[model samples]
Target chain A: MAELSEDRIAAYAASRLPGARDVAVSGLARISGGASRETYRLRLRYVDADGRSVERPLILRRDPPASLIETERHIEFAAYRAFHGSPVPVPQMLWLEEDPAHLDYPFFVAEELTGFESSPGALTGEAYDPVREKLGRRKWTILGEISRADPEALGLTTVMAKVAPEDCWRRELDYWEGVLDEDEVTPQPIIRAAIRWLRANPPPPAQKISVVHGDFRTGNFLYDAAGEIHGILDWEMAHLGDPLEDLGWGLNRIWCWGQNDLRGGLLPRDQAIAVWEQASGLKADPAALHWWELFNCVKGQGIWVSGAKAWSDGETRDPILIISAWRMFNPQDRAALELMGRL
Target chain B: MKPDPDAVLGYLAGLMVQTIAPQVQPQYLAGVIGMSGMLLGMAAQEWDRAADRLVKENRAIRGLFRQAERVGLDADLAQEVRALAGGQDDDLRISALESVNTGLRAALISLHAAVETRTDAASRALNDAIWAELSASTSRRAYTGSPF
Candidate 1:
């Protein structure tokens, strides 16, 4: 792998901007908690074709050699592009480069949503206490908007794989179960039992096929002290599926960062569901939602173990991978058990 | 060792989080240092209890296997369960105990699955026992500061 430097990014940016001059890149510092991508914050300076000197703060999301999840860069780029001007609040994507020769791997650049907090741990402090409920409402409302939006209208159907309402649960369950089979270092009897139960008792067909943000937890979004969400980020796992999938993922018990009954350390489980139902204008059938919630536990374990496998194999040395595996593995199991009424 | 490994690891974790992380640049390295400190704390917690946890868990699974005799599994699985049931944990090393534990747990999954198929009272009871053990297993491996 070639070393990623400021000059390489500048050269690439220059190439993208055909008539730009004095193209320079600086202040290149990596961001944290990107186990799937090498995320960096950089400053780009150039004199454009319009004879104007421009300086912009941008984000670079480059593919690592190995990642917790294997996803198509083009699909991720398209997801962000489709939802940029919509109510989704994603950063405007600038470029997507697949040729690894320029940056040692495929990467994309987008405008950075700076100066906002994205950590779930930050919400635990007293400073965020007053705004927690507002943030929770906004969180699920944005997710509701994402779920209710038409994939065909957004041009997402062209990029995302089409799945029928009935097949959504199986497709997702099979994919994650296969991930567990391949990556898990220890026996996952609990998840295995949950998988069997899910297969035996499938959920009803999705009310309507909608965009499922593969990850829609509290920490994935940028928020302000006023409890407003600015950008709903990390759409790398975005796909077309049952809309309830996103809600189930957000409602997963492992995301209860306060280690309490509060889901996402924000709202109580019922209130979050209510907020999502109102925003999306769709009913969350209790039984169907329960199935997806349990399934998300299996999916969650798959992600943690995949990261553990990557670190164990020496493919990447990102401490977040090990931290996730160590911190999340048991909670994920416990979450599954709770969903299965076995906890 | 003059000082205990748990104490040394705890001190190292504090140094990394309170001392080293604050001085790191670029913000990302600081976050990594902090997370490393957290991992060291987890490592310290595990160091003292790992061997004891594995031994107790191994013994518990062996007892479950002993009860598997009446579940009437297939011949191969029954023989396998019997064999595993008779085995003892003579090696006190964590690695050896863990290796045996893995095999037992893998077998436990098979037993649990087979037990689930039978509708008899004994099979049902054994199935519930397996679920109880599975739940207990998570509790055993759980960390003190887990977000769940």
Candidate 2:
């Protein structure tokens, strides 16, 4: 893989901006905790055809040699573009380059939503105590907006594969289960049992096939001290599926970072669900939501094991992979057990 | 070997977080150092418990296999269960115990799936026992301060 450099980024920016001169890239630094991609924060400066100097802080996400999850970059780009100005907040996507010849790997650049916090650990501090509830409300409310939005209207269906309402659970379950089958370093008897339970008691067909932001947990979004969400990020796993899948993922117990009953370490589970229901104008049928919650646990385990496998196989040396695997594997199993009423 | 590995690792983790991470250049490297500290802490916790956990779990799974005979599994599965149940964790090395543990757990999954199909009272009792064991397995692996 080609190493990311200021000159290479400048060259790519120059190519993208026709008639622009003296293009320069500076302050290029890789950011932390994006196990799926190599994310860099850089400043782009150039003189455009209009004879105006343009400068902007941008984020560059390039495909790594091995990723925690396999996803199509273009589809992720399209997802951002689809929701840029919508009710759901997302960074403005600037460019999507698929030709690995340009930067040694496919990548995309987007406007950096700076001066906000995204760490789940940050939310656990006393500084955020006052705004936690407000942030929690906005969190699930935005998720509800996403669940209510039509993939066809967002032009997402064109890029994302379409799925029937009934097959949403099966498709997602199959994909993640196959991930476990391929990448699990250790046998996951608990997840296997959960899978069997899910198959035995399938949820009612999705009320509607809405865009499922494959990962909608607390840490995936940017928030302010005032408890307002500035941008929703990490849509690499976005797809057309049952809207409840997103709901279930958000309500997962593994996200309760405070070690309390607060879902996502933000709001009580009932309050979050109520906020979501009110915003999306949809009913979260208890049984169906329960089914999706347990299914998300299985999906969660699949991801943790895959990271462990990637690290063990010498595919990537990123410490985040090993950290996440070690920290999350058992909690994920316990989450599954709780959901299955086996805990 | 003068100092215990867990103590050394714990001290190293504190050093990384309290000293090295803050001094590291480039935000990315700093974050890596901090997380490396966390991984070391987890390793420290697991080092003392891995062998004990694996041995106890191996014995528990063998017990389950023995009790599974009443469920009337198929010939091949029955033979496999019997073979695994008869074994003991004589080699106390972590690697050896883990190897045996994996095979036993795999067979346990097969037994679990088969047992779920039968509706007899014996099957029901065995199924309950399996769930109890599974729940206990999570308890055995649970880390202190775990979110769950």
- Which one is best on lDDT? 1
Q: Model 1: runs farther than 4 Å from truth?
A: none
**What share of the reference contacts survives in each candidate?**
0.71, 0.68
Q: Provide the DockQ value for model 2.
A: 0.75
Q: Give the CA lDDT, 0 to 100, for residue A4 in model 2.
A: 81
| Tens digits of lDDT, candidate 1, A186-279 | 8888988888899989999999999888999989999999999999988889999999999999999888895477789999999999999999
Segments in model 2 whose C-alpha atoms lie over 4 Å from true places? none
In model 1 chain A, the worst 10-residue window by lDDT is: A253-262
In Å, residue A276's CA in model 2 sits off its true spot by: 0.6
Judging by DockQ against the true structure, name the best candidate: 1
Residue-wise lDDT of candidate 2 within A1-343, one digit each (tens)?
5678999999999989999999999999998847899999999999999999999999999998887899999999999999999999999999999999999999999999999999999899999989999999999999999999988999998899988888989999999999999998888888999999999999999999898899999999999998899999999999999888999998888899845679999999899999999999899999999999999999999899888999999999899889778888888888888887888
